[model samples]
Structures are given as structure tokens and as C-alpha cells.
Target: MTDTKNEQQWERTISFADGGTRLDKFWGRELADEGVSRGRVKAWIESGLAKVNGRVVDKGKYKLAAGEKTVIGAAEPEAGEGAPDPVRGRLDVLFEDAAMLMVCKPAGLTTHPAPGEPGPTLVNLLLHRWPDIAADKSGMDEQRPGIVHRLDKDTSGVMAVARTEAARLKLSADFAEHNVFKVYLALVHGVPTPAQGTVDAPMGRHPSQKTKMAVVDKGGREARSDYRVLWTGPRGLASLVAVRIHTGRTHQIRVHMAHIGHPLLGDAVYGPRESAEWERRPDLLAGLAPRQMLHAFYLSVFHPETGEPVTRWLPPPEDFCALLAGLPRECLRVGVVGMPGGGKSALMRFLGAMGRPCFSADECVAELYNPGGDGAAMINQRFGGAYTLEDGGVDKPGLFAAMRESDQVRREVNDMVHPMVRHRCEEFFKAHRDEPVAYAEVPLLLEGGWHKEGMVDLVAGVRCPADKRTGELRRLRNLPPEILAVFDSWQWPEKDKLAACDFVADNSAGLDHLEREAERLDAAALAALADRDRATEAWMDGLWPGLAGELDRERAGGEGPA
Candidate 1:
């Protein structure tokens, strides 16, 4: 093979062993090391680029004779009239082969230049890097060399481009025949009912707007899209959806989704004026979208040269993830409760050390008892300075004594301080909304009736050997044996506490074992959170139906957490 500035040339003489071989097969076998396919060789032969005995033989089926010199010449792609100019810019090349190029086009990049649009499109970037594709003008639009399909300028994801003339023809035909598979991810206004359905509609240019595409009743091209609800945001504010298109048309997804009254979030053209309405909702993220929330998440096609399947999948972009993070979601909230000396705080510290947010009602109450705190102010206002301290804080010891003397005083004090602690817990949850799991140490979780208040998603009760709990109480607090009995009487029995819990951990083992239990709890809590995440659940169902139940049964039948 000889390479020139404008063309590539290969010369060979037929051997007696290959005398009866077809011309195309001969070149294919000889150029096998060059990665040229037999189909591509046949095209070259039929295009008059192959010659035998110094005469052009445009028939790929021509039988070759021994000692006949054959030459196959192919032109290197070159810039032609009306070709796009090469522009240097950042290009995210995903996968590349001799026949095609798969690239991840970022949002805000035009796939190709058009009138009144702009330069420096994806085509220009391809021309700048893979200059050989410039002369492969076999696409429907000559200006879009090597481009077999396109994504909207503001839409982001994986795309495929043909790098050679033969590849261009093959890919174009594949797309025209709807042989390529495409799946898009999007955030829409509301969850589509029935969870999954298809939209078969005809699309064309809008009747009144010349630039926009819409569902038309007459003289429109056939378009169909299948969509499945991935997950719905809190309060039906928004939803993540997956859409698969059977026929590619201009703005097919946007128009179809809007036609069904579920316009994509941030689609200013086809969407309703819900952005203005969403401004009133501070918790919803629909008002934060800078552009349409649509992504070409996955694509699959047959290899232009090898005929094998090629696929690419791109994750959501930064902006898309930002909006997703802004959506209201529930983090796994686990409330750890047990007797005072049962290592509840130790477990919480272990969870905190592992990067999960841990909250303590006792710590919150301590903060509330600080000077000028809400709990102190409420006590002072309601008790007429009887329980007020010199620093304008509540006199906790005096208040407890008074509460022991009077049931009404105890009820009043509980009403004043419990709400404050609950408010602090709410603030902690809000601050750590992005975290996967959080822990709260509430020793009176069941006695105070907060366990049934739906404050936490899971309740974990810790139990220690009776002697261990008694020893810790004696050593830590120097409490009298009578006080220990009174403390035990204030809460439920150990067995009852365990029964009320969703899960339990034994603290009879030392702190090292307790730390390992915390690790186990961390995994279990996160797994529970993922199990509740509708998007993840829906995705798992789509990928491996019934696998979750199988895994659940396996875990259930296996040993308990170590």
C-alpha cells in the first residue's frame, strides 16, 4: 500500500493459488491487515477505483486471472465546495474506529451550522480534528459532512458520525430504515399516568410559527415515542422520565411530550407557562433550569464497517444533576433509641465518623437551654420568672424538681421543650438533604411518643447485657441503685423496645464490635434508602425485573448483620 497526499494506492499481482478468486474478495483478503471490509472494497471497485492489467474493471464480481496486476486506489478525504471550516475547540470523543466516530456533544453546541445560526458547531470541531471526514459528503446535507444524525443545540448526549464515504452511506441507510436505537432522559412537569405508554403522532412545522415544530393533523411525518416514568418529585412537582424514539423527527420528543400535557421542564418553546407558576414553589427545581431538560442518554447502531453492534451511554450533565439535587427528596432517617447506658451515643458517633449526619435530641435540648434560646424564652414567658436563671436561661434542675412536684408543670415543660427539639431536627434534615442517610440519638424516642410521629424513616433499638448497662450507669453517673430502678421504670422493657424497632443491634459486645455494627447499619440504611428511591427502583426494574426480590430473599435467608 502506498499513501499519497490525495489518495491511497495498493498494488498486487494475482497468484495461481488465488487465480479464481473474485476481485473484491482478493482485495479484501490482501487488505485485511488494513481493516478494509469486503463491502467497502466492492464499492471502491464499482466506483472505477480498481483496475486490472492497466484497464479499469468496475465489476467487483470480475474473476481474477493469475499474473494480472491489479491496483485499488481510494482518495483521501479533502475539503470540498461549501464544506464546513475547521474550528479548534474542545471535543469529547467517546469512541472512535476506522468507520465511525462516537462523540459526547455538550449542551449549547450546535450539531451543524445552518442559516442564521452560528459556526464552531460539532461539525467544525470534527473537521478540525478528524480532517479526513471533510470530503465524505455522502450525508443528506452536503454541508454536514460525516454527520449521520443530529441533536438540538441545547440538548446533550452521545452521537455517531461516519468517517468514510462507505461508512456514511451505510449509516445513513441504517438511520433512514430506523435500525438505530435511541433512548433519551428528561425531566418533565408531572409524572405521566399509567407509568408507561406510547405516543404515536404526526409532526410538522407549526402553522403560525415558522421556526417551531408541533403535532400536526395533516401532511405531517410519522413519529412515535415510548416513555416510562422513572420517578416523580415530591408533591408531583416534577418527574424524571425515559423516552425511546422509534422514528426520528425534528423536536419529536418535545412536541410529543407537550402534546400529552407533560411538557419537559425548561422547554420554553413548547412548554406551558409553568415556570412562572413554579416560582411560587421554593422547594421545586423547575424554576432553576437554564434550558430544556432533555438528554440523549443512550444510542446503539450497527458498525458501519464490521457490522457488529456499537453502543454508547452518557451520564447526566452537571446542570442536569444540579437540578436533580435541587429536587426534594427524603434521606434515610434512622432514630437510635435505648436505655441511657446502652451505647446509643456511641453508635451515633460511629455513624458520624463514617460520614453520615448524626443528630442528638439531648444535644439539641442543651442548645435550647442556652441563654436567650427559644426554649428558655418560652419557659420564662410561661412560668412568670419562677424557672428563669440569672443568664435568662431555663433553670433545668429547678424545673425538673418542680415538675416532679406537679404533673401540670411537667406537662407544660414537655410541651415547651419538645417542639423546640423537633424544630432543630427538622433543620438538620434540611441542611443535609443531599446525604444518603442520617442518624438521630433520641433516648426517649418511644417514651415521648415521637417514635409514632413519623419523624424518622427507621427505628433502631440498641440493647446491652443487663449487667453491662447497670455497670455503665453506676460508673458514669454514680447513680444510686434506687435511681437506676426509677430510670428503668420510666421506659419500656428491653424486650418490648426491641419488638418496637424495625431492626436491632446488640451492644453486649465491646465498642469494637459496636463499631462494626455501625458499619453494618450504614450499609443497611443506605440499601434501604436506595430501595425507596423511586428512580433507582424503576431503573432496577427496567434492567433486571424480579432481581431485587431474589436478592431480598437471599439476604433474608442469610445470616443477620455481624
Candidate 2:
């Protein structure tokens, strides 16, 4: 029979990379094994059910980095491989009694039975030694019998378990609120920017792509992290970072630090390119570190019953030191549609400055029709030298007439120029790998199938009321109103551009204002990045060693001899 009194305990190694996450979320997508979706993950975050390191993280998009030990409500699942037994050797009991028990959990033990996983986990050991402790929490989750928090499989840590239902509820509640404190030791790749500082950025789901966390500007929940540089390594290539989290998010540390261009060495997922960790440090996993160079060392929180601070300490697993020290982890083709002299050039210039790498339709045509540049010689052969400049440049007006009136000529021109333009763009993107954001501002971002390809982020039109636009156009180029109408007819309206752009800046303001707006955007981008890292640090440091030790004990016993 299920015990109505204090019954059950939760502990295990919890890695964000693991199938069942140590982190808890009322609404976010469950880990792959948990069988939840992004929408559900969102629900968890919004409802304040998701948390890391025992603090509320109401955002579904928060992350769980390696070496994180997260304590949550009773609903928290047993993430990762923890069969019920500590290593198949002797057990170390810190405290034991009929009402309760606490143990210094060895790394490498499974907490309970998982599907298709028939091995002795911590639960198996409990059943073998203390038959009366079984309370049957299988109804909550199949894998996790009775759980409060999880340590990663390789993180050695301590844990507490309730012998009765009342004890279980109270313990879970204590962890849910920040009544618990956890600490971790991470052998990171580089020293943190400041000797001691906090990371405070909101966490959110990655956009555009799925299956990861991102430091988002909008639609995220608060995350705070604090860290201090412990010491530089003998070689100075690495350092120890001591961290604490005011809030928890999944993969918070790894993602936040990576966003700032530094990835935890030996971490594959959420890290820099795979080449850095794989090719550069092929011997990493074999030497001193068996797992990632991270360890959860301490956890402290107010004891629910005693109303006093209770702290737990653990040590880094041998595997953590075995790994080699280093690990490295636009635009639519716009066709200009406008009256013959409708400030198209000026508009194009404005769009370009906004960080869009635009490809002007006018420019495309000119380049294509250049001598020896696809249509250059062809234009000369078809139209003669007078129309085609000596330098082999095409006459824009002349070429337009021919292409519009003669489909054959248009086809011929397209045949030569279209392919070349496409190739150039491909090369351009390859070279601009360092740019975080990219865009293209063409007069006709929508005219061609360019924007349809989902390449362009936005369409911005530098426009003014007809009277003002006409006057400006006339001053720039001597074109008649009648001629300009045909040109402008194809041009998209200002309202249309507004609807199309993800964001819009009214260049209608003075030049100084426009510059200010750009600066504002730049500042905002940097600020967001900074805030994200801070928040992640808070979550990272939240990984107290108390739970990590339990996880490490489970993993060592479960896996084959390493």
C-alpha cells in the first residue's frame, strides 16, 4: 500500500542533454523522452512551474547546461540513466531512521526503472535493502518513482528522501521555493569577463529553429546568475568559475556563455562548431575528464521542518578530469518599381544602412549587361555600341524597352544574368559568417521571388507623400510626370512596405534622428546579449553539488567500464 505519511525521495544527475531533464516546467515541451511539445513547454514557463536550481523559471525556453542539479516540485522527473543502486559496492549512509534517511549518493546510479532499462538503480538498491520504503510514485512518471531534484549521471552528490507522504510533500515544497541553495564547480575554457559579476538575461525558446534555448529579447522570463573567477589554470588556457543562480533555466550556462562567443570545452550540443571540440582536442574524453569538466559541489537551503539552513556538499567525479582540458565548441532581389526619377537611389541607400545587404535591381541589370558580363557582349551584338557604352555598360532605358517588348531578348538577358547573380549571393553569405543579423533592402524586395524564399527579414520603403516625393524625384532626375507614373506604378506603397517589414524606421525624420535610431538599435542588441549572459550565469551557479554527487554514483555503476 502507498504510504500516506512521508514517503519517497528524489535525486539524480540532470543534464540538459539527457532525455529526461532535471529541470521542471509546467508548460514547456518535455524532454524528448518525456513526450511534450514546445507549446506545452510555454505553458510550464508561464504558469511558474518551470525552475532550475530550485528557483522559479516561468519561461519555457530556459536552458539546462551540463553539471546542473535542479530541484523542483514532486512532479519533477528522473532525468538520465540512474538505475536504483549506488555503485554495486558498499553504501554510505549519512543518516538513517524509520521516519527519514539521507545518503551521500555515489555517481552512476539510476534513481529508478526506465522503459527497456532493466538494471539496478538507486531504487533497486532501496528495495533490496529497505523493503518498506516503497511508496509507488509511478503514477506521476514511469521512470521517476519519487523525485524532487536530479543530478547528472556523472555528478557525485548528496540527496534526501522522505519515508512518508507528509515528508515528501514538505520536502518538495521546500525545494520548489528558493528555500534551497546549490553550488557547482566548473572547469570552463576561459576566464569570465569580470572577476565577479552576475548574468541577468531573460531566457526564451530559440526562434526560427526548434529544439534549443536562446537568449531572446521578447517573450521570455527572468533568469539571473552570479559568478566569480576561481583561478587560472597552470597553462592559463582554462579557469575555474564559481557560480550561483538566483533563477534556473535549462542549459542556461552553456547557452548564455556560448552566446557571448565562449563555449564550454568538450560540449558538443549548444557549443561552437563541432570542429573545435572534436578535431582540436581528440584526446579530451580519455585523460582526466570522462565527462564534461564540470562538477556540482554544494547545495544549501532552509530545512522545511527545522526552519534552518541545510547545506550539502559533493565532489567532482574522476571522469570530469579525464577529458583533455580544451574543447572548443537575405534578401530578396528587389526590382526598383518607381517613376523614372522617384528617389529610388536615395531609398536604396537608406535601406542598405539599416544592415540589409541589399541587391539593387538597377545595379543587377547594369552588371549583367556589362561587356563580357553575360549580356554585355550580347547587348552590343543586339543593339550596337551607341546604345551600349564603350565600357560595355548597358543602356538602362534601351535595355528595358527591348526586354519588355521582346520576350526573346528578355529571356536571353535573364539566361546570362540571373544565374550569375544567384551565385554571387551564395558567395556573399559564406564570407559574412561573423554577422549575427543580415538583411537586404531592394526597391522591390517583394517584386521577385526573393522575399518568398524567406531570405529577407524585412522590406523597408523610403517614402514620402506624393507631392514631396515627386518634387524630390524631379530634382534628382529630369523626368516628366507622365513618364514617372509608369515607373511609380510598379512601386509598392508606403503602407505596403510597413506591413511587410518586421520593423520599420521612419527616415521621414531628420538625418540626426535616423542616426540616433540606428545607435539605439545597436545599443539594444548589445544590451540584450549582456543581459542574457548574466541570467545564464545565475542559473549555472545554481547547480549545487548536493544533487550532482548522487547522479555521478548512478552513472558509474550503470555504464560499462570506461
Candidate 3:
């Protein structure tokens, strides 16, 4: 597995003969020429900065397997002895004390000087502000004397600087023990579902791209990020998200966001460049900034000497705010409608796999009928215990028998359950307002007049051939022919449903064929969303022809738009 020739940086694919070797041992031998110590390799593994087969692995003793790949990002070489160059720049100092200071580092500023490369950096500005910071050599690098933790060069926000050696040492220890609280704001291309959630995937160096990072499954450390949707853009084109990270892995937020399929807008490295959205709207793409739309807007840490928690938050930069103002503001909601045995469940599953939030009416009904649920009691009250079983539960077979006896029984059950299901679906949509696209499978959507009620942005119909549908019902569900016929009669004609729906998915063929059709429909839905956003923008433009330009100029002039 060792590639001795390019010791400083190399990735290796493990063959069958190299299987079962410890990851650290394998990498340490491979990167021996880069002066990589076994201890350093172990540190990398424990820090979640090692990868195997494109996934993060936290254990150094993880045994390699055949056909697995590993990535090694060797540490930067130590700098030669030289006097640090001090450059002048503006620094937004948030807090100051004898022990330490907090400053808002802007995007595009390097934290410290690199070996042999002497240009303006945040460290230089620190030196210019507090000359004594150059003398406080508490950090590992002499060039970064008073620095503790550092953000990526392009990431901006609150950062702490130590003014004294004692303060630097104390702060460094606090960071090492994960005592700092870091919050970032990002503008991502799609809204994450559930409004708030956690990404607990481990992170490590990208297997092939030396400069990038990825979520790996071997030789990586634990990395977790908690994110909440603050706001979503028009038609779910973009979202403003707040993220709090528990572990300070390199590119953790970027990698995790991309892993969840909502990469930050303008993130050229992690975001997809050749996506349909980009291809359709090159003008919108051209408006994006060169850097990723990530801002470390908030931080909280213990005071170096006082032992008191200090928190600070800074608003996002002008460019970030301006970009958001120009984008659209509507969310996407889709309703899936189909008859029994028409593959509504399969369609919902496919949509969910594509990162859309999906809700099933059948699942909701099941929840209502579960043990000790209120639906059973309601049924007993309505039918005078005729449908109640010995276990005090609603006897489904008895209810079906009653339904077959009288159409009034079926209507009564629908009256009891349909409103509850609709209420649940409404709550679901409200909770997931930040999502780009949300889907709900309502089998009786057209029959119940939900589409006419304006509850969905678009309706999708799933169509299956008559013989195939009957065969599926007979083989898979053992549904009686009479019951199936009743269900079919309750639904609208297939041709009418297909004509009414925005898109139709044919499930008569195999699943692969159905999946292909679903993908095309998904793409079409996204395109429609984009079109709605554009229409909204055009309407706004018509209302105020130069409003957007004026706002951009105001932002550029350091004044936020009203």
C-alpha cells in the first residue's frame, strides 16, 4: 500500500495481499519519506482526518481489506528560521482584554504566514495591532505566535487571539478539549429536511484530491454538525442555514453539507458545477461569488483568565447578503395521487431516496389505528362496538365486511379518517417549510378534491396496466377481486387522472423502468420550481425596475439594504 516515491502526498489502493494490515502502520510506512511519524499518523486517524474507500475511519488499528483505498494528507513542512513580516490591514476587534482579544476575520484572509510565502495575513494584522503578539510564542509555529485554532483561509468570522503566553497556553488547551462553541451561517443550494438535524458522519482527506476532504469510513475521526434551516429561497432554490459544529474537522461543514446533497451555494469545490440548475440558469450562476457561501458568524469560548464564557456574533459580509437578496423565495410542495396497486408507495420511496420529504397517507392511517389509538374508540362509538375485537382493537376484517354490506359504512369511515389525515399532512408541510421539495402520497387525492383545495403545487399520477395491477393485487396482497373492483370504482378514470396530473409515471413495467420515469419527473419538477422562481423575480423587477440594482449598490457601499 505504501507509495514511497511520492511520500509527501499519495493515495494507495489495497490489494488482496495487503489486506488485514493496520491503517496507521500501512500509511506510516507509505509516507516515511515525508518524515511522517507513526504518532502523527495515529493523531490524524483519531482526528477523523484519514479515509478508506472514500469514508472516514476513526480507528488507527482498523484492518485494511482488499479493493479498499486510503488517502494520506501529510502535514505541512516546518518553516525555516526568518523574521515574520508584518503587514497593515483592517481588523474588526469585537472584544479585548489583557489576556486575549476577539476579532472578526474576513473572508479571503489567511490565518498565518506559510513557509517561504510572505504575504499579508491575519497574523500580520494582529502584529500590527498588538506588537507583543509576535513575542508570545505559545503556539506550535513561531509565525502563528498567539493563534490557537484557525479557520480555513476563505472562511470568515469570530476568531480569538491570545496576547500573553499564559493566555495562549490556556486557550490552546481549551480548544484541544473541544470547549469552544462555533456557529456558522451558510447559503446552500437546497434546504435540508426536518428543518433541523445533525450530520454525524466522520471526515477525512479526500482519497484522490489532496486539497479536498471527504466523509470516509476508515482511519477517520468523529465529526458532527448540527444545522437548522433559518430561511428558504423562492421555489426552494436556496436556503439560509445556521450550523453549529461539535468537532473542528477540516472542511467538516462543506463535506457534510455536500454529503447530504445540499452543498453550499458558490462552493466550487464541493458543489456540483454541471447540475441542471446551473446549466439552465448561467446568469444566476454568474452572479455567485468566487468563494463558498460560508460564514463563521458566531463563537463562544471561555475567557482565558476570567474563566467566564464570552460569546460574539457578527453579521454576514456584504457579498453574502447581496447574493441572497437577488435569489427567489418560494418553496416546493408536490402531491402524489394514484389508485390502489398503482405503485404510489413505490413512487414515494423513489422520491424520498432523491432527498425529497415524503409522507404516506397509509402510514398516517396505520398510526391512527395502532394499539391504544383514538381511531379505534371513534370507530366503536360510531358502529356501537360491532367492529371492535376481543383485544379492544378495531377489527379490520369486520369493518371491511361492513363496508361490503353498505356503501354508507365506507363513507362514514372516510369521513372519520380523511380529515385527520389531511390535518396531519398539513402539519407535516408546515414543519418542513424550509425543504426545497416535499411529497405526500394521497391515494384519494383527486377523489377527495384535495387538488382543487389548493393544498399542493403539483399532482403526480402513477399508472399501472389493468392485468398487471390485478396480478399484483392477487399475488402480493391477496386482495379479493370484489374489493379491488370497489377500490377501482372509487378512483377517477386512469386517463382522466393522467390528464389532470402535472406528470405521470408508468409502473406497468419493471421497477428499473419505473425508476427511470421517476427520475425524469423529478427533474421536471425541479425545472418547474426554477421557472416559478424566475417568474417571481420578473414580477418583482416589473414592480420596481431598478430596485435590485439600488440594493446591490447599497450593500457594496457598506450599508445593508432596508
The pairs that clash in candidate 1 are: none
The number of residue pairs in model 3 that clash at the backbone is 16
lDDT at 365 for candidate 3?
Answer: 83
State the displacement of the C-alpha of residue 504, model 1, in Å, after optimal TM-score superposition. Answer: 13
- Identify the candidate with maximal TM-score: 1
- Cα lDDT tens digits for candidate 1, 396-497: 879877876787987788888887888788778656656788788877777777778777888998988888888874677777676576557657888888
lDDT of 1 at 414: 80
Better of 1 and 3 by TM-score: 1
What is the C-alpha local distance difference test score of each model? Answer: 0.76, 0.50, 0.74
**Which of the two, 1 or 2, has more lDDT?**
1
lDDT of 3 by residue, 117-201 (tens): 3457888888877887664343323456577778778888889888876676667656655667777888887778978999999
Taking all chains together, each candidate's TM-score versus the true structure is 0.50, 0.41, 0.49
Report the Cα lDDT for candidate 2.
Answer: 0.50
Model 1, residue 157: displacement in angstroms? 0.9
Tens-place lDDT digits, model 2, residues 50-97: 445434566544555443333332344333332243224455665555
Tell me the deviation in Å of residue 318 in model 1.
2.2
